[model samples]
Target: MKRITTDELRAMAGREGLIIQGCGGDLTELVNGINDMLTQEGILQNGDAFKDVSVFEYDGCTNLLFSMENVDLNIGKLAMWRLQSHETFGGTWLSDYLPNRLGVDMDQPPAQKEKPDCALIGQDGNIFNLIGIASRTLKENGLGEQAKEMRERIIASGSYDKALCIIGEYVNITSAEDAQEQDCGFEMGQSY
Candidate 1:
């Protein structure tokens, strides 16, 4: 298998309209996961492995995107695996099991019962996006109040960067309304 640099990954993200954040890891595991899915489906010759993986930097975080062309499966299991493995929440054994258990043939045309092409990942790895696991962590660590305050602060900041900083630090605040106002140039709901 070959490895591609973060810059290459970023270029692909630009072309594909995907946003990636946070530090990137070896990505080999993610690649392998996809290869496994593809092998099981008999898309390529069995035992074929990923040839390239890459990461990119965006905003304040790094993003990863890779391609394993000539993949046997119809829709591309590597893409599916990367999405499932990287998402911050809702990726359970059931989620993984259901796709394989249903035995939907990748080569066959889409059927009513077949799983759809999809990719699921967290928006910011924040509590709101990961309520199930984050809530439990907050409760267990006695951070309920802190978590609530941080949420408010983030909403109030109206500055994506500020909110991201606070969320990154897991900081607490009284209210988002109290955050100092700043002109982010873009109107509300505008993409950054």
Candidate 2:
């Protein structure tokens, strides 16, 4: 799959387009999820608004994006949704084409830039299985396509360490010992 370069993403900022976060699953399912999310939030009343949105891979993140060339959408509502939900499933828009109706800057990054953490220790020692686990985690969190790309990149990685490095780019790795400690506590606390 072709990767969207950061430069290309920067160029997109001027267009009246959007890059929504927290979208995952199969392409079709993700699109549905996007529509559901928007509809639940009362951003839109219909599901067809996101039919043209596609999975856009940028900066190791899988985002649902509406590029300039994409079918026209209610970008005004989407921009407001991004601002209103700044604390949840946060997203940003390409500001160059933005109408500035919200009075907030779209080019600025959020308060936090932390990547989500994925437990790595105590996982299957095999690289492929590790990739599967990481991919599943990502998918559950709305990064389905990023997970696919991570899997492919890890497979092509020359060594296990290199694969781990690639994985780290997408998520923070929790140590095995820490996982074991937590699991031990959970087991001890179990009533059964």
Each model's lDDT: 0.41, 0.61
Cα error, residue 124 of model 1, in Å, equals: 53
Among these predicted structures, which one has the highest TM-score?
A: 2
User: How does candidate 1 fare on TM-score?
Assistant: 0.28
What TM-score should be assigned to candidate 2? Answer: 0.38
What is candidate 1's local distance difference test score?
A: 0.41
Candidate 1, poorest ten consecutive residues by summed lDDT: 111-120
lDDT of 1 by residue, 1-192 (tens): 333443333222112211223545655665566456557756446566545334444445544433433333444543454366556521222223223433433345432221111111322455445333433444333344445666677778877667656655553322222222223555456585
Tell me each candidate's TM-score: 0.28, 0.38
Q: Stretches of candidate 1 above 4 Å error? A: 1-23, 37-45, 76-192
Q: RMSD to native for every prediction?
A: 19.8, 12.3
Clashes in model 1: which pairs?
A: 6-55, 43-72, 44-72, 152-176, 156-176
